[model samples]
Target: MTATVAAPAIRVQGLVKSYGDLRVLRGVDFDVARGSVFALLGSNGAGKTTVVRILSTLLRSDAGTATVDGFDVAARPGEVRESISLTGQFAAVDEILTGRENLVLVARLRHLPDPGVVADDLLERFRLTDAAERRVATYSGGMRRRLDIAMSLIGDPPVIFLDEPTTGLDPQARLDVWAGIRALAERGTTVLLTTQYLDEAEQLADRIAILHGGRIIADGTLAELKRLLPPATVEYVEKQPSLEDVFLAIVGTDPDSEPADVITLEEQR
Candidate 1:
């Protein structure tokens, strides 16, 4: 007997979208495998957000097709919406509500049974339990992003769209969001992450597709993409720390640790 192959969690073929004179997505195509993170790597105005909106049923494509969880985005938008969660560039958390209140509110909105229980579980999962009752106004960027993500997972959607999930965050806060994304993929959820940060893609995506001029310029695993370039040259030069190194050293240096690793700006030069 022939074994059946599981279908991709997300499939987009020849997707086209336009805004009057501006053509955003020109025949875009890609597939996201189950339980994997797919990064739509691109710069601003590369139509990354356009692709996501179409996939989430918030916008329609002029041509081509997209499906989520085996349901056609155009024909069965309701089913597609049910199977996916979308977290846009900015956090959608309520500043007035406590972290726990925000989660419970989403649970109640989804009409889930035992909303409180669901909220508690998610607070624990996202490491927000300790700050559960604290108003979001006092939460840091990382904490707010975590709660936003936790709310998105209330119904346990199989697919998630993270549009520039780490934009505008400090380095440490960005790492926090990356951790949450990894946990999602570990639990068998398909993630479609759109970002301009190449390092973010490198750190989280199972596959990366670079979009430029409204089309995919390159698509592959990091190793595969690297192969497109000439072999890397190995060489050594005088070692010097940059401003980022100086900043990190100043911010994260230990009181009792040796000062050898922490170089002054003068030394960096």
Candidate 2:
């Protein structure tokens, strides 16, 4: 007996997209294995969002093909939509509504049998139960982002697209979102994330593709990408005291002088 290979959750081949004469994606090719996180890394205007839009069926490509969960994005848009959820750079929650209301709204829109039940379940899952009744306006950035992702899961889609999910978040808030993303993959969901932060991709993605010049210049795991570069080289420089040290020394030598205001390293930058 022969074993069968599972189809990839996402597959793109020769995918091309353009607006007027400005081409975005150029022959980009990659595959995201089922039940794993695949990150697309690129600078602004490098076509990361274009790829997500194409895969989510929000935009049609000029040439080539993309499939999500075995459904063609262009040819079977409804089927593709049924299998995927998208959370773009900005959180889509209604500010006036409470977190619970937001989730219930999505569940109702999806025509779930019991919207309240689904909403409560997701609130528990995302650890938003305590804040479920609080207006989203009062939630922190991380809370709102978690609720945004929770809303996307209303229909339990097999694939999720998160475009710059942690953009503008503080370090702790970013880590919270990262934990949520990992939990999704742990439950067998396929995640495709686009991010500008290299460390975000390094910490979350099972595989990564670097987009440059409207094309995927590199694609592989972090280790694989590292292997593509020259071998590591390390050099150490002798320690030198900063301006703070010099100021402290001067102050100690001359107690008669008034103390200077403390300056942070960031202020120097």
Per-prediction TM-score, please?
Answer: 0.91, 0.86
Model 1, span 47-139: residue lDDT tens: 999999999999999999999999999999999989999999999999999999999999999999999999999999988888899999999
lDDT of 2 at 80: 95
Q: Lowest-scoring 10 consecutive residues by lDDT in candidate 1?
A: 253-262
**Top TM-score prediction, candidate number:** 1
lDDT of each: 0.91, 0.91
In Å, residue 31's CA in model 2 sits off its true spot by 0.5
Q: Write the per-residue lDDT of candidate 2 for residues 64-131, one digit (tens) a residue.
A: 99999999999999999999999999999999999999988889888899999999998988878988
TM-score for predicted model 2 compared with the true structure: 0.86
Off by over 4 Å in 2: 234-269
